[model samples]
Target: MAETGAPRRQSLGFLLLYALAWAGGAMAYVPFLTILLPARMTALVGVSDVEYLGYVTFCGAVAASLAGIAFGWLSDVTRNRRGWIAAGLVLTILLLLAVPLAKDVWTLIGIILLWQLALNMVLSPLAAWAGDCVPDEQKGLLGGLIALSPALGAWSGAIATTPGLVSVDGRLAVVAGLVLLAVTPVLLFGRPRPFPELTAPPPVCADGDVAARPRGPAVRMWLARLLVQIAEAALFAYLYFWFRSIDPAMQDNEKARLFSVALTLAVPVALLAGRWADRRDRPFLPLVIGASVSAMGLVGMALAGDAGMAKASYLIFGIATTVFLSLHSGQTLRILPRSDRRGRDLGVFNLTNTVPSLIMPWLTISLVPGFGFETLFLLLAALAAGAVLLLATLPRGR
Candidate 1:
């Protein structure tokens, strides 16, 4: 690999810039289940009878994965990552505004697909930008920043969806508007000083090989992370419904509060885990421990048929998952094939995250309906356990 100079420790200003940008990008993503397409909107579209919304979401994931790969590759080819990022922000804002206006399921699906593609367009390139500027030494901090994105998104989305703040559709439009407005200054004024372009291709191995090969340990680790994410997606995407099913009297505001609390706890845990992994060079340990704990949390949620127990389960699940994800992401940065192609590879790696969402609707709608949420939670627990086993088989390194 063409080694760049020692990675400069990114300043707090830069990290904040990236985090805010990511938070804006996140509003396009994390709120879909929680705020954007709640039951009311589902009923508004008249596809409530069939599971069309699930299929729509699946298609959105597919679009996001494909767009992420495509845009990441294009950013590499063009050597102009910022331009793509700016364009994606603009497009996502516009599409998000259009979503509430869609009168039919097909229109909503179309808008969602486009919005996902636009969001990925920015996300893939931005992730690559991190690898481009940040060195291995700073991976832990970068991972922490990345982990914060979801929490920030959830927090902002909850605020936007608070009752009487705006109608469901109007809230989405406002979210889109706010993201667009906030992103504009960053994209326009907070310009990063340009770095010299890499005139030569990345270096090959000692034997002069150029083809990218998936590292064995890394692939194993990726699979472990993938399974961990599957459990997470299943729980997060359906947790609101799970709450409602468990307590029919639960208000939307209360559910949002619980979700916020869970995320608030998760953020610090993730940051602490990332810092600890960096200092101790014990990346795998956190993942293994986190997965095992998360599985236990899932089991707790399953057994907790009442509201109080469910709240406790959410706390456990949040902490465990946060730790696992932070360590897992840091480890991922260490294992990717090409430092120069971090965006492309990470985008591919992200498939491990996105693909589960594509499949989860099937599990949630088809399987969960037949077997019930308790059985589904049990399956999630099993998946988390499987992640632990997979991680156990991987070779450890600093």
Candidate 2:
């Protein structure tokens, strides 16, 4: 396979545009999982919310894992990132619009599973495009920009849950509209630049080249991300429920607003961290710090006795997680061995993202109902600490 060679540095304007498109795509689906799906599941299954959430998330995880690899490989074969993303977005919109039609838990599960596949069809390739196009020098900055997505996603969720959007169908329509509007800029200006020259991979002997080993850093990077993602999955997918559990009087929109505020505050912190890492060439440090900081926040949340304390704890956790994740996303592009297989490799790495979804619900059910959310939060803190340790092992400049 021919490589696209090193992608040239993009101008700030182009970077911002790309980031906005990614943010738009994120908004389309994140709210559904973070806020809408859980709410819907509560309404659909009542007392069985934990069990049903586990079932639905497990199914979605399977679909996401399968679809990520399949579509990622297909994008590699087709070399058509734009086409795959556009198709995925369209299908996801249609499926989202149909969400209100689900009359039973089983039916809703089926729709959500399909929605997972469609969402990944967009996300996998879109992630690969970053690996394909973004240069290493700018990855941290890009990561900082990517932090904005969650902030925007949370805000969009707030919009969806607003009082005026009385029906599920109406909320879905508005979210879909926002997605379309957000992605329009990228669709208009996101053409792949001509590669000018195709590069070849280094020759490998039968046993593989010992002088240069790319697999170690890549695998370690993925593992580091996995731990943090597990922590994040534990928080993100259940954030709404957790907040409501802490404060029954809190409105859905208020939860969304607070979530957005936490993420929004993290934006500058993330960007600064990214810039510092890029400048110092100590990217791993930020990842470690992020994990450590988040673990602290989780510990605080676990020990909190009041809603106010819990909210403050969440704010800390949210900021740290945002920084960790955004930087991780940037650093990932720096470690890939083969640009030619960016899509497939990234899809494989995305398992860290999908696999956590599979584990988190079961983790929640096993712990939350039996012990309490405190137990879950403490466990997540331990996992995050583990992520910090794992990241500490990476080779410098990796």
TM-score of each: 0.90, 0.93
- For lDDT, the strongest prediction is 2
Residue-level lDDT tens digits of model 1 in 297-379? 99998899788998899789877886677557666766777656767787888798788888888888876778778888888
Which one is best on TM-score? 2
TM-score of 1: 0.90
- Candidate 1 C-alpha RMSD relative to the actual structure: 3.2
Clashing pairs in 2: none
Which residue segments of model 2 deviate by more than 4 Å? 1-8, 191-213
Clashing pairs in 1: none
lDDT of 2 by residue, 175-238 (tens): 8888888776787787544333221333567888532336878888898889889988888888
**What are the lDDT scores of the predictions, listed in order?**
0.74, 0.84
